[model samples]
Target: MRGAAMSLSAAASGFVVFLLSVSVVQGQDDWGVTYTSTEICALKGSTVDISCTYRYPSRINDHITQVKEKFWFTRVSNNDYVDIRSDPEYSGRVQYIFGNNDCTLRITDLRESDSAEYKLRFITNQHNGKYTGSPGVTLSVTGMVTDLQVQVSRLLVYKSYNRAELKCHSSCRLPDHLHYVWYKNRQKMWRGTSSYSVSVYPADSYSCAVEGYEKFPSPPVYAPRVPSVSVSPSGEIVEGSSVTLTCSSDANPAANYTWYKENEVSPKASGQIFTITDFRPEHSGNYYCEAQNRRGRHNSTLHLIVVAGKFLHSATHILYQKS
Candidate 1:
């Protein structure tokens, strides 16, 4: 009776081993299959996907069994899968993409550090005490832009403080990822985490800037735009005689000035100076200047009054009488 009991115990142990072996070969469900992903993805800052497809080799393509649970493990993306269960780093953020061969791995806010290859596979306990899985898919995420682009705008431009109009302009723009700031001579003028417009003295230089994502290549520094200016000769001229009028102005890129004759409707866009060599009644009138820049043109008026003939004109007249 004792010998018979020993035989029965050995038989039971052999049976258990056989079952375990079967689980290992049949892949838990004894479907006799192994699966893995042949797909590959690029890099971070961009996006990539890992997909898996499998079917039983023992059965026809149409007879393949569907593995309900599929998941992936990533080294860099930190993406997790819920259907196959994943680590905490990727939990909640991952989900099984229904009706699709690929799972939805929404990597929020892509960063540079998210770079690495990932593993993919399926899980099953169809054959008790055994679990089956497919090989992992290798992927690489690449960073596209080394720096973030910034948009810039100017709120005010002027010449002499308060005397003329101050102008601001929108120069360049990119993705709305950056905050705008203004500067002059390397000094931060306005911190517009809120707005872009600013008013300041004309003597100071200016520039606009935008920052976003804390990335490099913020914005290229641009020279400030300056208002155009014009002026007549600084010295005094003889009365009843004509004086040559001159106009000038300063601007970022140089500006153009056109001279308008007083009472007359045409412009003398010629020499810097308009010389009326012969002083006469017609030589005097309301004098003004028109200044132009990339933006457009503007006018500044000068009320010039010519005095009576001076000693020089008198001497000339006397010489003419003698002749």
Candidate 2:
């Protein structure tokens, strides 16, 4: 109800704010306030304007009702309304603009705590000419840094590609009609709905941001890239010698690695590094590392050969490398 005085009350439970509207009685219009809007949703570190017009009778008990003071307050402390401008938390951030029968409250550098019901209250020269606009305006501020996130969901992974769902998410409720911008490798891809579906590749990175705040995009999310396998000694796996195999991959959520030898039903080892203290011919085979995450997995193979037995006992060296 634009400019209509309505009795209002609010109750906050958890993260949700609820506003209740009630009918105003007749004769309350003689001195009442009308707001341009009753609800506002803004992003953190942004600015907002809550404007309203007020009314008062010309005379009370035959005395002129001269306006003495007008201000905005969200609550009453010690049975007195505290002016928003005087609040230390809002100091240097609140500006009041008064025009012909209208008053606008301008707030800058908004914070999540600024989410509250703001009301317009005024005092007149007359003894009983004080009025407060009930159920004023509700301001809900979302975040610019912490809350915005890109949530990744793995739909399906087949062969060399993975089907994924990406959602632009926030801690507080934002307007449902907000246009979202998607980024692939930090480059703008398209502007569309908040949720997007795309085929994922191992080397691609994805992020999301609101349309107007592209610079503050959510952290990039990507699948594990093809892993690279390496050996510590890098030369040869000699009999009764120790050797270590390491697998590494780049992924948003770090990938977990498993070591397996060809023809083995179960995994040989679990971790980024797999070590064999006593090298033997039985360990000579095609050993592959599987780097896996929620997104998908990739394998890198390393062929190992042990230089043992009397035939090559004095050979001292055997070449082993990753395949």
Q: List the candidates' TM-scores in order.
A: 0.29, 0.55
lDDT: worst 10-residue window of model 2: 310-319
Give the per-residue lDDT digits (tens) of candidate 2, residues 1-323. 33432222221211222222342321276877877767776667666667777888998788877899999999899998999988998988888888755788877777889999999999988887788888788898866634577777546767677788888886544545568899999999989988999887776788888777777788887766777787766655456777888889887668888888888899989999999887777767787888777666767787766554411211112122111
Candidate 1 per-residue lDDT over residues 5-61, each given as its tens digit: 000011111110000011111133333222222333322332233333333333334
lDDT of 2: 0.72
Candidate 1: which stretches are off by over 4 Å? Answer: 1-177, 211-248, 253-258, 261-281, 284-288, 292-323
- Residue pairs in clash, model 2: none
What does the lDDT read for residue 175 in candidate 2? 49
- Which candidate number maximizes lDDT? 2
| Global Cα RMSD, each model | 21.8, 11.6
- The positional error of residue 226 in candidate 1, measured at the CA in angstroms, is 10
